[model samples]
Target: MSKWTEIRDGMVSALDVSDVVESAKDQLITDLTGDGMDALSTVADKFITQVQVQAESEQGWCMVRDKFVLPLMINGILWAVKLVLAKSTPATATQPEAPTGDSQQ
Candidate 1:
């Protein structure tokens, strides 16, 4: 077999062994702690809820902005201004019409 083939096989074997070792470690931890999957799941749930609440609070515009309405109005006006500018800008002039000529004599 080629050296390359041998190397590929060795890498695959190593990955398989690593996976087994990690699985065993997780099982050992679960068994020793007795917290098992249920405890882990509850912690995960609380973490998710806290993250959601924090995200919502942070995203509340009124809390951060003194004049939230003004900012939204300004944004709308800017968007409209951009749209008008884009519409008024002339497009590149069309290519000059090709001369009318019969291709086949």
Candidate 2:
């Protein structure tokens, strides 16, 4: 496989693992009470913040794509997936509403 393919696969795997880990942490918090829940929440928050920082880093984007465009595209795809799975009704097709007032030049 190509290097890019390998990198993509690795990233997906990492994301999956992160999801699982977060779930497990959540479960632990649910199963515990008081201090345990607070501790787990603190750790989870730190982990999430670290991941976000890494994801938004300039070097992180450049290491994969010379430009940051690819990451934005990937983010868009993930957003679409969430929209597809969400419980709300799918958006209805509608005509664009014309300007209610006079159009600006």
Candidate 3:
């Protein structure tokens, strides 16, 4: 894809990351309603707006337009990243284990 917008469009499909956006939205709503959260509810509202703005095709997340090298939707992006990291080593994340050798041949 020659255009940045095309790459952005294709990446969502190629990487199958569309669900991540939905997941983030759900998480935001959860945070908005849930108690004992570290931050205020209004932060979630701002993040939700950023997620919507980034998800829009017309917006398409451009640096020139949005002035972002880190992306305006970075909270959602970071949420997905944190999700991936959390899932990456579930066993180890929850419980400590001895550093062992590979099980497979």
Candidate 2 to native Cα RMSD, angstroms: 19.3
Candidate that would win on lDDT:
3
Writing each residue's lDDT as its tens digit, candidate 3 over 32-66 gives 33442335335655765675576554454553344
lDDT (0 to 1) per candidate = 0.54, 0.53, 0.54
- Candidate 2, residues 1-105, lDDT tens digits: the string is 999999999988878754566556544434444454456556655654555566555576454552445545655655564444332322231235667787677
TM-scores, all candidates, are 0.26, 0.26, 0.23
Off by over 4 Å in 1: 1-67, 93-105
Regions of candidate 3 where Cα sits further than 4 Å from its true position: 1-72, 95-105
Superposed Cα deviation of residue 90, candidate 3 (Å): 4.5
Kindly indicate the candidate among 1 and 3 with the higher lDDT.
3
What is the per-residue lDDT of model 1 for residues 1-105, given as tens digits with 9 covering 90 to 100?
999999999999878854566556545554533444345446545654555455545656643342344445545655565555444433332246676887767
Candidate 1 at residue 53, lDDT? 54
In model 3, the worst 10-residue window by lDDT is 32-41
